[model samples]
Target: MARSSTEAEYRGMAHAREIANNPVQHDRTKHVEVDRHVIKEKLDVKLVDIPLVKIQEQLADVLTQAVSASRFQDSLDKLGSGDIYAPT
Candidate 1:
């Protein structure tokens, strides 16, 4: 289910996604404002869908974060995999 988010939250997601997807950065700080509108347009047109995933429930954390043994196993299970390299 898609969760409701505040305008600031949406904009923040849009801004972060823009930065991550694009390699080039503007020299001037003022150009940073345009990133929000560009991403907002993509959302408005259904070009992109940003679903909220809670930090604890994020599957990517298995690889990116220092999760506990149980949490790592949980994430791997969610991805339909076994704890092949789980801490012994």
Candidate 2:
């Protein structure tokens, strides 16, 4: 049976933290299935980190929707990004 998204997120959080800290064990996490190995490999190679951001502070919306000018600049500042073609 498939787990719900919330359940899967919580479950993955627990197992990922543990799996990330220990050496890879192909047979160690059989209970959680095999997908975790992909995350573990990424962690092993320093490809990413999971950081929690508040919903209001999420910047991805800037890319997906229209935002006010100030809000757009705020998001850009938060990301340390800027427009290169603006008048100097």
Candidate 3:
């Protein structure tokens, strides 16, 4: 049931066109400007199909190491810090 790359790209273009035509929130004006530029630049670009892989299969060890290192650093930084401990 998966769509071909060309079909998916067509759908993505249609969705982008819809968003470009309808500017929603005031804060989105800047984003819409960027999207407009991107759309114009990519108007004639061909779609390339990139193979997809499961997250666990692709990034299991790498992500695990990154998350573990981040958590370790965060825990180290949180230990024992207070103005009350200053010499008075």
Candidate 4:
């Protein structure tokens, strides 16, 4: 569902779908969800700051997809940390 679907199809999908959907959807989304749009808006207005994520602390790869043994091990090493990918 996450890897194969087009951005438009994803927006039309359940849960991952946008709440205030338009007739035409964006080809690529700057925000992953409706609530995330707030952060994007804040970023555009310089109201929030973004923090960097260390390579070793990034665990989203596990949920994202299968990877090399080394990378999977890295993910397992830090499964409870905060999400690393910066929004907006």
Q: Which is superior by TM-score, 1 or 4?
A: 1
lDDT of 4 by residue, 1-88 (tens): 4673354356556533553354345434535555588889999999998989874566775666557887786676566444366474
TM-score for each predicted model, relative to the true structure: 0.43, 0.38, 0.31, 0.41
Give candidate 2's TM-score.
0.38
State residue 79's C-alpha deviation in candidate 1, in Å: 1.0
* Clash list (residue pairs), candidate 3: none
How do the candidates rank by lDDT, highest first? Answer: 2, 1, 4, 3
Across 6-84, the per-residue lDDT of candidate 3 in tens digits comes to 5666886777677767757334656767886777666647343346875434333332344465554454445533356
Q: What TM-score does model 4 achieve against the real structure? A: 0.41
lDDT by residue (1-88, candidate 2, tens digit) is: 2245456668868877878567665357666656677788887898978778886687965775667888889999999897899888
Could you tally the backbone clashes for each prediction? Answer: 0, 0, 0, 0
Candidate 1 displacement at residue 64 in angstroms: 1.5
Model 1, span 5-56: residue lDDT tens: 3554687777767776666643344465688789999999999999998888
Model 1 clashes, total count: 0
Between 2 and 4, whose lDDT is larger? 2
lDDT of each: 0.73, 0.73, 0.54, 0.62
> Which scores better on lDDT, 1 or 4?
1
